[model samples]
Target: MATLTILKYPDARLRQKSKPVEVFDETLHTFLDDMYETMMDSNGVGLAAIQVGNPLQVLVINIPREDNEQYKEDMLEIINPVFLKQEGEIEWDEGCLSVPNFYESIKRFDEVTIAYNDRYGNEKVLQAQGFLAVAIQHEIDHLNGILFVDKLPILRRKKFEKELKRIQKEQSQ
Candidate 1:
């Protein structure tokens, strides 16, 4: 498994909407493994295919649990997720690999039921709550070309725009 480069915030490619994954062959399986590797290497809980320059509706999430020993055991290889139900409200200090060095209190559903496919194209339904729910929603947004900062309040969004500009400048230097 390779660690793919994550697209940074404000990168035009990050705004590209992902297309649904149509194949579940070995190639897809390998790419999923690479995505998982990349997410772990970046210390991110979730990563979408589009973040790695692939515009496919695929994402991998590994919610860390107590003891942190259950890392890979809880990996969710979701493809083409469709939210079936979302309830309650939760505000999480969400961060993204694309949006480095920033954390925002973003409101999201506390619970969610989503229908998605596994790495092998096996349809599955997951009912997630709390942090798990938030991570799933965050990755889904990436698939739709929506960044967490875009969901922030206007003031915060403006602040992030300035920060993003600074980061871009540093990258170009």
Candidate 2:
């Protein structure tokens, strides 16, 4: 599996809604493997296809252990996920592969019942709470053309935009 380039924030492609996975085959599995490698290489716990410039409703996640290490066996490759139910609320300090170094406190469901397809097109349902739920919601947002940064308040959003401009300018120089 090879690592893929993660598209950063403000990339127009990231704002594009992803299309549902129409076919599940070796090709899809290969892309999932590469997505897993890319996530691990970047120290990201989860990634969506849109983050890598692919407009597919695909995502991979590996919830870290107590030691904060992720195991391959624990990685989940999910396709065309939908939230069946969500309840309660929790604010998490969230970060994203696409958003780079910026992190923000965002409120999301504390529990979620989600339905998704596996790489082989097997439908699965999962009831998750806490961090796992947050991770799933975050990735799903990417699939829906929403960014964690978009959840920020107006003042914070303005601040982030200013900071992003500064960072891009530095990188260009």
Candidate 3:
């Protein structure tokens, strides 16, 4: 599997909403494999297809187990995932691969239940809490053209925008 380029924030394409995956074929399988590799290579816990320039509702997540600090081989490959339920609330510092080097405390559901189609076209439901729940919600937001920064307070978002501009300018120089 090949690693795909992750689109950084401020890229207009990232603002586009993703369409659902319609076919569960070989191409879809290959794409998911590549996405998984890309996410792992970038040391990201979760990634959305739109982050890699594919406007499809696909996401992969591999939250390392706390006890062993090792990620399970079975990474979550979700297609057309939809939130079935959310309950409780927790505030945690969150980061995104697209918005590199930025973290902000955000409130999110403490528990979430999501329904999704697997790589093999089988429908599945997952219940997640803590970090996993937060990660899933973050990735799903990407599918809807939403970024973690978008959830930030207006003043904080403006501050981040100024910082992002400074970083981009420095890189260009």
Candidate 4:
């Protein structure tokens, strides 16, 4: 496994929509392993392929449970994920691996049923709730070229504008 370079905010590649994975092969598996390494190294609960400069519909998510008990064993490696059904609504403070050091209250579906191809290229359908659900949706949005910052309210957006610019400038250097 290798750590992939995560594209930070203002990177044009982050705004580019990802392509679907046509064939899940050894290369795809290697990429997924690298993505997992990248996500763990960055301390992010979830990551999308586009975040690492690969514009492909892939994501990994593993949010720890609050109680720190035996969390669900499902460390999802979803390829070409699709939201089959969604229900209810909740507003949660959301953060992104791409947009660092900023959290905002973004409205998201509280529950979701997703259909995706697993790492082994097996079709699977699953339901996610609470934080896991929110994380899933957030990363999926990245595949569609949408950032959490774009979902922010105007006032909030302006509040972070300077910080965003500063980060971008520093990254370039």
Query: By TM-score, who's the top model here?
Result: 2
Estimate the TM-score of every prediction.
0.95, 0.98, 0.96, 0.91
lDDT of each: 0.94, 0.95, 0.92, 0.89
**What TM-score would candidate 4 get against the native?**
0.91
Clashes of 3: 0
Clashes of each: 0, 0, 0, 0
lDDT of 4 by residue, 41-156 (tens): 88888999999999999999988767754233757899989899999998989988888898889999999999999988899998998898899999999999999989888988
Quote the positional error of residue 160 for candidate 1 in Å: 1.2
lDDT-based ranking, best first? 2, 1, 3, 4
Candidate 1: tens digits of C-alpha lDDT, residues 1-173 = 88899998778999999999898999999999999999999998999999999999999999988876437878999999999999999999999999899999999999999999998889999999999999999999999999999999999999989988888789899
Q: Which prediction has the highest lDDT against the true structure? A: 2
Alpha-carbon shift of residue 165 in model 3 (angstroms): 1.3
**Model 4 stretches with alpha carbons more than 4 Å out:** 67-73, 166-173
In angstroms, the error of model 2 at 20 is 0.9
Of models 2 and 4, which has the larger TM-score? 2
Per-residue CA lDDT of model 2 for 1-173, tens digit only, reads: 88999998889999999999989999999999999999999999999999999999999999999998899999989899999999999999999988889999999999999999999999999999999999999999999999999999999999999999999999999
Pairwise TM-score winner, candidates 1 and 4: 1
By TM-score, how accurate is candidate 3?
0.96
Q: Identify the runs in model 1 with alpha carbons over 4 angstroms from their true place.
A: 170-173
**Candidate 3 or 4, higher lDDT?**
3
Name every residue pair that clashes in candidate 3.
Answer: none
Regions of candidate 2 where Cα sits further than 4 Å from its true position: none
